[model samples]
Every structure is written in structure tokens, then in C-alpha cells.
Target: MKGWRAFLLRRLAGTAAVVLLLSIGVFGLLYLAPGSVQQTLLGIRPATAETIAAVQARYHLNDPVAVQYLRWLGGVLRGDLGTSIRTGVPVADMLGLRLPLTLALTGYGTLLAALAGVPLGVLGALRRGRAADRLVVTAGVVGLSAPPFAVGLLLLVVFALGLGWFPVYGAGEGLADQAWHLTLPAAALAVGAVGMLVRFSRAALVRELEQDYVVFARARGLAGPVVLGYALRNSLVPILTAAGLIVTGMLAGTVLVEVTFALPGLGSLLVESVTFKDVPVVQALALLLTLLIAAVNLLVDVGYSLVDPRVRLGGGPS
Candidate 1:
């Protein structure tokens, strides 16, 4: 128990350190980006000297970048994310309303990816060198090759415009309606993830099936299905890792998907915030997304222990 407790504490400390660095990097990039907030607010035309000076004074734009970063960091530490210059709303409030929407979109898409990927992977692994295996492999390769936006655009054209099946855009008015609207965007996000998962899962399982234990099980007259199940259980750690990575990637990739679908999610907000140079909004969103990715990694690590008892998160051997 003490070892596990120590292990968790160490893991948490590492996560906190990484998050701090991530926030610093993200904040640093914002300052380095072209155009000041005032410039974005002012549009294409250049502002007069006096107007620029006034704008800087109003928003503390003239403060040293390090000082500004410290001030913002201090506010964040105090649960005050500062107000959005663009919308005149508290950044935290804006995120509160939008974060859940983004999470739902990403989560649902990941669910679809896993459901589609895992079984197909298992099937291909079991039927290696056959037509089914070739087809699955081909699909995965195509998915990996295509960008998510292209997939989103193509799906929009075919399923939304051509087939007239799912809606082209928007988050929709109600739960059922939103689910319907999310279908294509979710599918687009899931495509690459599903493909990668299938390929990884197939390879992991095939590797496991070739192990002496698997052969011994077969020699001992174990049913094929039972042996397959055993191989699957053993293969899960790597598969889980792959799924976690896909989920993390989905968070970053959501911007294009959300833009394509017109969902009022954080990805869209981040894009808009960047475009308008909404420093508070952009900073807060980056920190939040980084935290989410960290959380996912932690969860996957815990999942590893659950899927395989020989592995322990408390600095023990696999």
C-alpha cells in the first residue's frame, strides 16, 4: 500500500511539473505570434500612435512579457482565469459552457473508434494472410494517409450533401438531434483512430498468439476461442496505450472537425480566440486541453494495471 501510494504521488508530481512546462510554452508562443491583441482588434488598418498607446494601457499590453505571464499565472492559480477581451466574458465562464461540449464530441468519437477498431483488429489477426486481413490492413493504411479535415470534407459532401443522411453542421438543439448532427464529424475523427487501432491491435495479438504460452494452451486442448480470448487479454496493455494516444490526438485534431461541423466547442473557440488574439481565452484553453491529455495518460496507466495484474503503477515491474 505504501509503495503504491508513493508511486501515485510521484506520478502526480511528474504530471504537475509537465503541466507547468506546457502552460509556460503555450503562453510563450502566444506572445511570440505575430500581431498584438490591439492589432487584431483594430483590423487591417494601422492604428494611430495615441490609439495604440491607449490600447496597450487599457490591456497592460506594454508590460514585460514575463511580468504579464506571471500576472496571468497568478490569476490562474487563484481560480481567476481573467476575462475574454473579445467577448467581455470571464474566460472560465466561457470554458465552463464550452468544454463539456468539446469533451462530449471527442469522447463519443473515441468510443466509436474503439468499438470499430478493436473487433476488426481481432478478426484480422485471427484471419491473417486472408482477404479479411488484407482488407482491414488496406483500410487502416488509407485512414492513416488521409488528414481528418479532408475526411470531414469528403464525408460532408457524400453523407451530408450527397446521401442527405446526416446534417452538414451545427451542434443541434437537443440531445438526440445533437447526436444525429455529430455523426459525420464523429465518423471523421474516428476514421484515423480506428485505422490505427486496428493495425496496432492486430500486430499485438498476432505477436501474443505466437508466444510459447499460446502454443502450450493450444497443445493442452484449449478451445480456439478460449485461447484467442487469453491472447487478447495479454495484448490489451499496448492496445490501451494506442487508444489513449488516439484520444489525445483527437483533442488537438478537433479544431478542424469542430470548424467543419460548426460545433460550439472549445476547439472552435480556441481557433477564434487565436484569430482575434484573445490571450486569456487562448491561454486558458491550452492549459485545459493539456490537463485533459495528462489526465487521459494517467487513466491509461491505471488501465494498464487493471488489464494486467503483473503490471503495477507503483514503480513495480510489468
Candidate 2:
């Protein structure tokens, strides 16, 4: 009980620190932009003093940058992310609608990668020098080397244009429709993820297969499948850790993939916000992304205990 309490407290502290850093970064980015807030708001080549004062008054831009930052931070803490400069809509609401699409795309892509990668990895490890192993290695290399947008375009050309099996762009009308449109993009994102997972899993399994415990299991009359399963299960801890990190990376990487596919997701919103200099929207999105990454790391740490009994037995702090 004490250990669990300590773990929770540590995670809370880390989260708080991350949130503080993110807030500071957001504030600094807004303040350090090339032009003043008034200049940015007016969209004019030359800023008259009268116009500048009027604009500053309109948006409370005349306040000290620190004061403005605190006001925004306070609003965020109160669950209000402020209004977008471009659309004049609440940033929180915009994110609320778009966040689900991004999550869905990432979740499906990760699932596909894991499903395809793990089995291929196990097969490659078990086959060692066979043709199948060579093919897996080559495929993994290609997946890793290819750019995601290029892969997405190629898939669109083949599946949507040439074969007419799927839509070329847009996330379609509903959730199910969106998923259908997401197929190509998700596969594109999954390519690199699967490649990395395959290589990691295969190497880990190979190392585990050579361990003394694996040999002992084999000597104890365990069949090939049983011994392999035991070894693979033990080796999965590191793979899970790697997968967690990969998921976090995918959260960021999905921006390009989403854009390529024209999906109405957080990534697309972020791009639009940056282009328009929608300060509140951009800050909220960045802070949310950081929180997501931190949350995933915490989940993976907890998963370590679930995967290995030694971890739950107070082996050491993760």
C-alpha cells in the first residue's frame, strides 16, 4: 500500500512539473514571435499608433506579458482554454471535438502495427536463417526507410485511385465512415511502427531463447511451443516499454499523416492554428499533447508491474 501511494505521489509530481514547463513554453512562444500581438491581430503592413492602441485595448494586449500569461494560465486551470483568434470559438471545444479523431487514428494504427509486427517477429526469430526471416527483415527495413506521407500517397493511389477500394481523402461522415477513410493513413503510420516492433521483438526473443532458463525449460520436457511461449512472454517487458514510447511518438507523427489524409483531427487543427497564429489554440494543443505523452509513460511504468511479478514484489522503483 505504501509503495503504491509513493508511486502515485511521484507520478503526480512529475505531471505537475510537466504542466508548469508546458505553460512556460507556451507563454514564451507567444511573446517571442516576430511581431507584437497588436501587429499580428491587425494583419496590416504598417501599424499606426492609434491602431496599435485600439488593438491592444481590444485584446488586453497592453498588459505585461507575465500578467497575460497568468490570466491565460488561470483560465486554463479553470477548464477554459480561451477563444481562438481565427474562428472566435472556444479552444477547449475545438479540441474536444478533434481530439477523438486523432485518438482513433492513433489507436487503430498502433493496434494494426502490434498485430502484424509481433507475429512476424516471433516467426522470424523461430525461423532464424529461413527465407521468411529474410523477407521480414527486408520488409522492416523498407518500412523504416519510407516516409509516412509518401507511403500514404502511394496507398491512396493504389487502393483509392487504381483499385477504387477506398476513398482518396477526407474522414467521411460518421465514426464508421471515418474509420474507412482512415485505413490508408493508419496503415501508412503503422508501417514504421511495425518495423521497429518487429526488429525489437525478434532480437529480444532471440536473446531470451538463448537464456539458461529457456534451455532448462526445454530440458524439462517442455515442447517447442511451450518453451517458446515461456521465453517470449518473459521477453515482452522491454517490447511493451518500446511500444509505449512509440505510441507517444505516433501522437506527434500523426500530424503529417492526418494532413495527408485530410482528416479533421487535432493534428489538422494544430497546423491551422499555427498558420493563423491562434495563440490560445496552439498553446492548448501543445499542453494537451505533452500531457498525453506523460500519461502514456506513466501507464507503461504501471504495466511493468503487471507484466512481471518481480516488479510488483517491490523489486525497485521504475
Candidate 3:
């Protein structure tokens, strides 16, 4: 218990440090960008000295980068993500409105990948060198090669436009409707991850099956299901790692999928915010994403110990 707690604390500290460094790096890039914040905010209008000064005062554009970052960080700690320069809306509020949809989409996609990938992977491994294995491998290749945007567009054409099955646009209201609306978009985000997971899980399971322990277990007259279960349990670490990576990739891929599907999620918000030079929104979103990835990694690390008793987080088993 003590070692596990220490391990978790260390991971948390490291995550904080990484988030700080990345935040600074991104802030520096924004600071060094061509043109001033005032110009971006006041676009198309003549930039008089007085107007520029006012804008600078309003947003602290004259402050040093370190000072600006500290101020922003303080606001973030207080749950104030800053107000949007474009719409005067709070960045937190904007995020609050959009984040649920994004989370739903990401969760749905991840669920699909796991549900489809693990079984398929297990099948492929169990039937190695058979027609089923070949088919699974071939499908994985095709799925992996297809980009999320392309898959999204294809799904729209086939299901929404041609077959007239699902809705063509808009994130529907209520849980059931939202799930219905997000189905195609989630699938698009998940397809590549499913392929990767399939390949990874199959390989991991195959490796585990070849281990001496598995051979010994088989020789001990364990039932087939019991043997397979043991193998699966031993291979979970790699599968969990793959899941973490898939989640991160899905978060990044949301931008393209959201645009292709016209969903008003964080991905679309990010695109619009960048296009309009909405600095606060972009900064907040970027940091939020970093935190989310860090959280996922930490969870995966903790899961390592939970899923495999032989595994120790900070050191060899106590």
C-alpha cells in the first residue's frame, strides 16, 4: 500500500511537471507569433495606438510571458478559463457546453474498439494460419489504411445519404438520441484504433500462449477456456498500453472526424477558435487535452498493478 501510494504520488508529480513545460512551450509559441493579440482581436479595423493600448491593457498583452502564464494558470485553478475575445463568453462555459459531446464521442469510439478488437484479436490468435486469421489481418490492414475523415465521409454517404438510416447532421438531444447521432462519427474515429488493437492484442496473446507457463498449464490438463483465460490475463498489460495509445490518438483524430461529421464538439470548436485566433480558447483546450492524456497514462500505470499481481509499480513486489 505504501509503495503504491508513493508510486501514484510520483506519477502525479511527473504529470504536473510535464503539463507545466508543455504549457510554457505553447505559451512561448503564441508569444512569438507574427502580429500582436490586439491585431488579431481587432481584425479588419484600423489599429490606432489608443485602441491597441486598450486591447493590450485588457488582455495583459504587455506582460512578460511568465507573468501571463502564471495569471492564466491561476485563473484555471479557480475554474475560470478566461473570457473569449471573440464572443465575450467564458472559455470555461464554452468548454462546458462542448466537452460532454466530445467525451461521449471519445468514450463511444473507445468502447467500440475494445468490444470489436479484443474478440477479433483472440480469434485471430487462436486460429493462427487459418482463413479466419488471414481475413482478420486483411481487414485490419484496410481499416488502418483508411483515414478517419475518409471513413466518416464514406459512412455518411452510405448510411445517412444513400441508405437513409442515421441522421446526416447535428448532435441529437438526450442520451439515446445523442448516442444514435454519434454512432457513425464514433465508428470513424474507432476504426483505425480497432485495427491497431486487433493486431496488438493478437500478437500479445500469441506471445503469451507460447510462454513456458502456458505450456505447463496446458500439460496440467487445464480446460481450453481456463488455459485461454490465463493467457488472456497475462497479456492484459500490453493490451492496456495499446488502449491508452488508442485513446490519445482518438482525441487527436476527433478534429477531423468532427469536421467531417459537422458535430459541435471540442474538435470543431478548436478549429473555429484557431481560425478566429481565439487564444484563450485554444490555450485552455490544449492544456485540458494535455491533462487528459496525462490522466489516462496515470490510470494505465495503476491498472498495471491491479491487473497483474506479479507486477509492482515502484519496485519488486513487497
Candidate 4:
């Protein structure tokens, strides 16, 4: 716990700097996008001078790019993310409502991935060349190869259409209802993550099992299960890293899952914002996603420290 705490504190400064730099990059990208924000928002290729002037005055479009970016960055630092160019609503307020829904979907999918993938991977590694192990490995490969949309559609057909278990569309009404509805999308998102975890976990376990420690444990007359447990514990750092990457992918918004299920999430919000040229929303979401990915990576690093003493005590950012 002490080392984990220390590692987190060590990472905080670096994480903040990365987020700040990424926010700048995102802001600049959106700023350089084709046509002026006024033109896009107003749906006019050539907007009137008076109208453009009004917008420039209201949003400070006439300000220097650095000034504009600093102004937005200042607002972000002050608990504001600016108003949406399309909705005229505060971008933060819009995200505040939708963020949790996206989080729920991501959490659900991640939970599913961890629960199924980790155990199946361990089982496959333990079994090695057995039929069940082969099946598990093949299943994981297929899951990885298939696209999320295609996997989602196939799941929709089998569970939502054939068996009629889960909702076919929408996130549904209440929490319980939403959980039921989110199952298919969650499964779709989980497919690729599960594959990655299975592959990583099995490989990590196999490598750990081959280490001298495991052989020593066996020579000391430890039970097979005890040695396996020891290896599994030691293998967790790599597994956690893979899991963190999965969550990063999830936070980036599982675009197809949200789109296919008609779920309101940051991913879909991002798509809609881009389509409507909601520059503020787009910039805010992009920045938020970047920070989230950074945070996840930070946590994964902290996880390494927790799992391995070398990382916690002496390893620095390796």
C-alpha cells in the first residue's frame, strides 16, 4: 500500500503534464479543421460578415489561437469546458449527464472481459494442448479477428433476435433495464478485450510457470495448485497492463457498440459533435478521452508497482 501510494504520487506530475500537452494538440487539431467554426455551426459555407463578426465577438474567434487555447484551457482548469457550438448548452453539463452512461457500458464490458477471459486463459495455459485448451484459444482468436460491429450484429441476431433475451436497441429505461439492454453491446465490446486478455494472460502464465521459482517450488514438494497460484500471482502485472489497454480502448468510446445499440455515450457524442461541427464539444470530449487514457495508463503503472517489488522499490518508469 505504501509503495502503491508513492508510485501514484510519482506519476501524478507526469500524468498532468501529458494531459496538458494532449489537450493542446486536440485543441489545435479542431482549430485547424476545414471551414470556420461559425460556418460549420451556422450550416453556411459562406457566412455573412455581420453574423461572423457576432460569433467572433461572442466566442472570441478573432482572438489569437494561443489566446483562444489558453482561454479554453483556463476554463477547463476552472471546472468549465465551454458551451457547445451547436446546442448552446455548456459542454461540461452535456458530458456530466452522458459520461456515467458511457462509464457504465465500459465497466460492464470490462467486467465481462475480466471474468471470462482471465479464467479461460489460465485454464488454456494449464491444459496446454488439450481439446478444451485448443477450443478456448481458437475462440479467443476468432473474437479478436472479428470487428466489433460484426460481432455485435451476430450477438444481436443470436441473443436479441433468436433467443430474445436482451434488448435489441437503446440502453433501455432504468438501471436494471439498462443492464439488460446493455448486455449485447457489452458482449461486443468484451470480445476483442477478452481475446487480448486471454492471449496475454496465457502467455504471461506460461512464461511464469517456466521460471526457476516454479521449478524450485515443485522441488520443495509444493502442491501443483500451490505452484500454479504462485505463478498466477507473479503473472498479474502483464495481465493488468493488457486490462488497462482494454479500458483505454473502452474509454475511447467503443464507437461501433454505442452506434449499433443506439446508446448515448461519449463515443456517439463525439461522432455527433463532429458531424454537426460542435467544436467545443469535440475539443472537450477529445481532451477528456486523452486524459482518461493517460489516467488508465497511470493506474496500470501503479498496478505494476503493487504486483512487483522491484517496480515499487527501485524501478522508475520502466
Top candidate on TM-score is: 1
**TM-scores for the candidates:** 0.95, 0.92, 0.92, 0.88
Superposition error at 317 for model 3 (Å) = 5.2
Off by over 4 Å in 4: 1-10, 44-47, 219-221, 313-318
Clashes of 1: 0
Q: Candidate 2: which stretches are off by over 4 Å?
A: 35-40, 43-51, 313-318
Across 237-312, the per-residue lDDT of candidate 1 in tens digits comes to 9999999999999999899999988889999999999888798898899889878998899899889889999987
Model 1 global lDDT (CA atoms, 0 to 1): 0.90
RMSD of 4: 2.9
**lDDT for each candidate structure:** 0.90, 0.86, 0.90, 0.85
Compose the digit string of candidate 2's lDDT tens values, residues 1-318. Answer: 888888788888988898888878877886786655565677855788888888778778878888888988899889888998777898888998999889988998999899999898999999888999999988888888888888998998899999999998888888788889888989998999888888989989999999999989888888999898888888888889769967997899888988988888998898888776678888899889988998899788888888777776233844
> Over the stretch 75-94, how does candidate 3's per-residue lDDT look in tens digits?
88887889987788999899
Clash number for every model?
0, 0, 0, 0
Instruction: Please state the error at residue 297 of candidate 2 in Å.
Output: 1.2
C-alpha positional error of residue 105 in candidate 2 after TM-score superposition, expressed in Å: 0.3
* Candidate 1: RMSD to truth: 1.8
User: Against the true structure, candidate 2 has what lDDT?
Assistant: 0.86
> Of the pair 3 and 4, which is ahead by TM-score?
3
Instruction: Estimate, for each residue in 1-318, the C-alpha lDDT of model 4 and write its tens digit.
Output: 676567666677777787788778877877777767777656745587888888889888899989988898898889888999888899989998888888899999999999999999999999888998899899889878878888899998999899998888887889899899888898899999899999999999989988999999999999999999899999998999899989998776377788888888888898898777676788788777877787788778767878876674334643
